[model samples]
Target: MPVDPDKARALAFPPVTVTVERGRLRMFAQVIGETDPVYVDPAAARAAGHPDLPVPPTFFFSLEMESPDPWSYLADLGVDLRRVLHGEQEFSYHAMVYAGDTVELRPRIIDVYTRKGGALEFLVKRTDIRRDDRLVAEATAVIVVRDPEVAS
Candidate 1:
């Protein structure tokens, strides 16, 4: 079955929130192979001008994944999950992500269009990492969803 361009165009998703913790920060640092003292040492972070351990740039992916499952959301639009492929991912960072921060992410469909080959879906996800209402960082992700047939 072909994807319902109209329904896919009208889809909306809910936002999700994630709280940064010391353990998570440590784990992320390990995964990214970061040997920076500021990532694991609070005292070092403070001395370095950060309130807490600073997470790596790619840590934003952890927060973005917390959003509602895109597969389930698309299924509601009559698109099969098995036919979807992650075409692209890009991130823009405004500031550093540090421990002891709470982040809220809102994922919205920015645009939807169909190509001669297949469907192309673009999503603009905004993440606000804050500390006591103070903006710590703003991250935007552009995700491209491609049809499986066209991907092959």
Candidate 2:
């Protein structure tokens, strides 16, 4: 089945809130091989002028995934999980986020398009991260779905 671009654009997803924890930040930094003390140590981050342990690059994506049933939007769109590919990911930071900060993520579909006569569908989702209703960062993700009808 082909994706309905209009429907996709009209989709409204509920917002999710996540609290940044120092231990989790430290653990994530260790897992990602981040040697920056500011990302793992509150004192180091404070020494570096941050109020708390700073979040690592790309870590916001994981925070956004804190949503329960993160993949439910795709499922609701009737997308085949097996044929979906992560095409691209981008982030624009407006302000620094740190441990102990509670951030809210509001996601929406920015665009939806098809190519190769509908064999490839691209869904662009943009998430706005806010702390106390103040914009902190914007994350964009492009999802590519291969149409089995045309590809096969």
* Top-lDDT candidate index: 2
Give stretches of model 1 more than 4 Å off: 68-70, 80-82, 119-152
Residue 51 Cα positional deviation in candidate 2, in Å, after optimal superposition? 1.2
TM-scores, in order shown? 0.71, 0.94
Residue 139 lDDT in model 2?
95
Clashing residue pairs, backbone N/CA/C < 3 A, model 2: none
**Root-mean-square deviation of candidate 1:** 3.4
Q: Candidate 1 on 3-113: residue-level lDDT in tens?
A: 555665466666567777888888877877888888878898899999888877677777666665735666676556665656555566666777777777655555565
Which stretches in model 2 have alpha-carbon errors above 4 Å?
none
TM-score of 1: 0.71
- For residue 41, give model 1's deviation from the true position in Å: 2.4
Q: List the pairs of residues colliding in candidate 1.
A: none
